[model samples]
Target chain A: MPTEPLAKRPGGRSARVQAAVYQALTDLAGERDVTRLTIPAVAERAGVNPTTIYRRWGTLQALLAEVAVARGTDAPPSSSGDLRTDLEAYAVRTLADLTRPGGIAFFRAEVSPDIDERRSGLRECLQRATAGLDMVLEASRGRGETPPPAERLLDQIVAPLYFRVVFSVPDTDEAYARALVADLFSGTWHSAVELH
Target chain B: MPTEPLAKRPGGRSARVQAAVYQALTDLAGERDVTRLTIPAVAERAGVNPTTIYRRWGTLQALLAEVAVARGTDAPPSSSGDLRTDLEAYAVRTLADLTRPGGIAFFRAEVSPDIDERRSGLRECLQRATAGLDMVLEASRGRGETPPPAERLLDQIVAPLYFRVVFSVPDTDEAYARALVADLFSGTWHSAVELH
Candidate 1:
C-alpha cells in the first residue's frame, strides 16, 4: 500500500506528524474495523511515536473524526443544471463510492459511535454534497416548474439515498431517483410547506 | 420513573435478569448517555449484583444489544385501511418515540464499537416497520390505486421518512406527516411507472 503524505503545506514537524497519523488511520480502516484499532498499531503504521498521535488528536475518537472530515473534503462536488439528471448522477456516484471495497467499512466504523462532533461532520458533508439539489429546486421555482420550500424538495429527494448507504443496503436505482425528482417538481410538494 | 417489566413469563432466572437489566438501561437512558454507563452502575440500578450482570450479559456492549432488541420489538405494526394514512401514522409514532426525552439519548448510546449485532437489531426493526407499509401498498394494488413492483412504492414512500429519521435532523410535525402522505399518493408516483 502506498502511504502518500496527506497535505503538502509549508508547516512545521507537527503538521507532518498529523498527516502521518491520519494516513495510518486510513490504512487501518481499509484493513479492519476501527473499533479494534489501537494507538500503538496506528503509530507503528505511521512510523511515529504513540505520544505524537495522543498530543495531536487527544483521543482515538478525535482522530477518527478528523480522518472522516478529511476524507469527506476530498470528494468532488456535483453541479449539473438539470435537477433530475444531477440527482441521479449524485445517487449513482454515492452508491458507487459506498459499495466499494473499503467504503462501507469506513462509514460503519465512523457512524457506529454517535459522537456529537463526528455526527456534525457527517451532516456537514451531506449538506455540502446536496447543496446543488437545493439550487436546482430554486431554479425550478424561478421557472414556475415547482413550488417553494427548497429544503423539503432537497430532503425528500436526497435523504433516502444516504439512508440506504448508512444502513449498508443496496443503492437507489436510476428509476427511483427520477421518480423522486418528478415528485419534487410536482405541485404536491406545496402541501408540506406547512411542515417547514 | 415507572419501571415496566419486559418479560411476562418471568419463570426462568435468566429471563428475570434480562428484564431487570433492560429496565435499568431504560432508567439510565432517561438520565445520561448509555455509552458512559458502567456495569456496576447498571447492577446497582437494577438492584442486582454486578457479578450477576456480567455472568448473564457478558459485557456492557452485549447488555446494550439485548436492551436495544427488546426496545425495538415494541414498534407498532403499520395498519389502517389507507396506505397514506397508515404510513403517516407509523411515521408520527416513530418520530414521537425517537424524539421523546430518553429516545434519542438511548439511540445514541446504543451506537458504539463492536455493536453490529445491536445495529442489526435496529435494521430488523426497520424491516418490520417497512413490511407493514408494504402491506398497505399491496392493498393499494388490490384496489388498483397503485402499480406493480411493490418495492418501488416501498422505496418512494417509506425510504424518505426513514432517511429523515436516520440522516437528517428529524421533523415530526403532523403537517409534515400529512405532506409526506400527499406527495406519495399524488400522480407523481404513477408518473414514475409511465416513464419506466
Candidate 2:
C-alpha cells in the first residue's frame, strides 16, 4: 500500500510551519535512509523556504533536535497527588514521544557528538529530560522523605525508562514505572542517600 | 589535525578480516554518515571482496551490528560474589563500550528497525546487555531471596547506566553501580516480589 504524506491540523502559523518541517523530515526518513537527509529536501517537502530553514536552524542536526524537543515534550507534567501515578504519567509520555516514528531517530542524532557538531540548544533537551524527574523529586521531599540525590533519582528512575525507550528493551508501562518508583522508595532510598 | 586511519595489531587471519572490516566501516562513517554505508564502499576500503561480505553477513546492518557486538562486548562478566562489586564492573564496562567513539554509533544504527531490517544476531547484544542482571538474578535466587523480575532489575540498575551511557546525563561509575545494587537488595526486593 502507498503511504500518505503526514499532515496535521492547522494551528498558529508558526506551529504549522514547525509541524510541516518536522513531518517532512520524518517523511523523508520514510522514503530513504535518514543519513541522506538534506535541508533542501525537507524544505521542499515542508513547502517552506530553504533559506528560512538555514536562517532558523543553520543545520539539519539542529532542526531535528528542535523537532524532537517540540514533538516529544509538549505535554506538561501530570501532578497526581500520589507520586507513583505522577511518575508513571511522565514515563508514559516520554516513552510515547521518543519511541514514536521519528522521535528516537532525532534524539539519537542529537546525541551523536560527530553528526551534531553545531552542539546548539541540545542542553535544553537534557534539562527537559529531567524536568519531570525534578517534579517527582519535589514530591518525594514533600512526602517527608529525604530524596536521593538528583543524580540518583535520574539514574534509578529516568534513566531506565529512557534506556528501555531507546533500546526497545523492556516494555514501558505504568506497571513498569510504578515498580521502579516503588523500589526507589523502599529501603533502597535510605541506603542510597547514605551512600552519597 | 588530520585523523589517522584506524589500524589494529596483527592477529590471526579471522581477526584481521574483522579488524579490517570494522576499521573500514568506521572510516566510512567518518567520511560520510553511516546510513550511506554500502558493502561496496566497505569492500573498497577493506580490500575485501563484496561477495565475501554478502556471503558472510548479507547486509550492512548485520555487519554493523556484528562490529558493535564484537567491539562492545569483548570484556567478559566479572564474577564477584558480592552483587554490588559485580554490578559495578558490568556497568563500568558497558558505559565504556557504548560511549566509545564508534560504539554508540554502531548500536544506534543497529537498533533502527529500518537500517537493521535483517535484524540478524542483534539479540546477542541484547543478551550481553542483560548478562550482568541475569547473574545478579541468579545470585538472588541462590541467597534464598526472590529476585525482582528481570524487568525490574533492568529498569532500576541496568537502564540507568545505559541511560547515562547514551545521553551523558547521569554519570556512570563503580560508586553509581554499587549504590544501585545495594538499593535493589536492601528492602525493595521483598516488597516488589510480594507486589508481583
Candidate 3:
C-alpha cells in the first residue's frame, strides 16, 4: 500500500503564504544587513499584508528562527521503532544536513545569539526540535525500553556536531556522528553519578 | 616579587600600538556593522598608519580573532600541578568568561563563521588556546600521569559549555562546568571503544 499521502499536503493558502514569506525574507537577508531587516519589509516583498505577518510571526526574529529550523533542522529521520536506530538515523541526517552547502549558515542562524534576547525565537525553535525527539523517546518508554534522556541525546550527539562545525574543527563526518550515537547507547557516558 | 611585574609589563611601543588598535577596533565595531568594519577604518580611528595594522594582523579577521581571544578566552587558569585541578579550574574560568556581560558576544565573534573562510584567524586563536591546555597536559605527562587527549577534553568539556550557550540551553553555570570536569575524569566516557 502507498504511504499516507507522504505527510499532510501543504497546498493550503497559508502554506503558500509561508513559502512566499520565507523566500522574501531569504532574499532580503542576502541583499542587506539582517540587523536592519524588518517584518514590514518582508511582508512587502512577499506581497502579504503586514498585519498577517505580524499576527502569524509576531516578530522578525521568530520568522527567522522558523525559517532556519525549516531549512535544515526540522527534517528528522522517521521513527523506526528501535530507539537506537531512530537516534542514529537522526544523528546521521543532522550531520549530513549541517555539512551540506549553506546548511551551516542555517544552523548558525538557528543558534545566533543576536536573535535570542526578549522574544527568544531560537529557544522556541529548540523546544520544537526537542519535542520531536521526545516523541521518539516516549515511544521507547511505552515499549518498556529505557531510552536516554532527550537532553543527553542533545548534549552528546547534537552539541558536538554543531561545535565541530562552528569551531571549524575537522572530521565531523558520518563516522563521527555514528560514533556519538554509539557512545550514548553504550552506557559509558551515563555510568557516572548522573549529575544533571 | 610582585608577581614578576604582573607577568611581564607590556610597556613596549609595539604593545602600545597593539592596545590602541584593539581599542579602536572595538570602538569601530560598536559604532558600525561588523560586516562593514575595515582595517583602514580601525587604523584611522587609532591614529596609526594603515600599514601598521596590515603588518601586524595581516587581515581584519585576524585582528578580530585576536581581540576576541584577548577579551575572554586567552586567560586560562594558571596550571596547577594536578591535571584534574587544572582542567576544572580552566573550565570554570571559561564558563565565567562566557557568561560575563558582553562575554558571549566576544565568543560569538571568535566562532563567527563569517570570518573563517580565508586566513583562518579563529583557527589560530583556537590553536593558541589549545596550546595553553597542552602545556597543562604535558606537565601531567611529565609527572607520569596518563593525561586524556587534548581533543577529547575539548569535545567533552569545552564543546558542551559553548554548545549550551550558543543553543541557549539553560544551566551552564559554574556547577555545571565543574561537573563536566568530573565526568571527564570518571573514566566512564572513555570506557567505550575509542572511535578516534
lDDT of each: 0.59, 0.65, 0.68
What's the TM-score, to 2 decimals, of chain B in model 1? 0.69
Enumerate residue pairs that collide in model 1.
Answer: none
DockQ of prediction 1: 0.31
Over the full model, what C-alpha lDDT does candidate 2 score relative to the true structure?
Answer: 0.65
lDDT of 1 by residue, B32-133 (tens): 333456789888988889998888678776676566656666766645666566667765665655555456444444443444743675566557556666
Best by DockQ: 2
Candidate 2 regions exceeding 4 Å error are A1-19, A26-41, A48-58, A113-122, A139-146, A193-196, B1-16, B23-60, B78-84, B113-122, B135-146, B190-196
**Local error of candidate 2 at A76, Å?**
2.7
Model 2 — interface RMS deviation? Answer: 4.3
Could you estimate the TM-score for every candidate? Answer: 0.75, 0.73, 0.70
Q: Give the TM-score of candidate 1.
A: 0.75
Share of real interface contacts recovered by each model?
A: 0.26, 0.49, 0.33
Q: What DockQ was computed for model 3?
A: 0.25
Q: Which lDDT tens digits does candidate 3 get at residues A1-196?
A: 4331223564677778888898987777654234336789889999999998999888675677667656644474567888778777777876776666544445545544443342265576567557667877887787777777787777777778877766668777888888877777655544542312
Q: What lDDT score goes with residue A178 in model 3?
A: 86
- For the second chain, the TM-scores of the candidates in order are 0.69, 0.68, 0.66
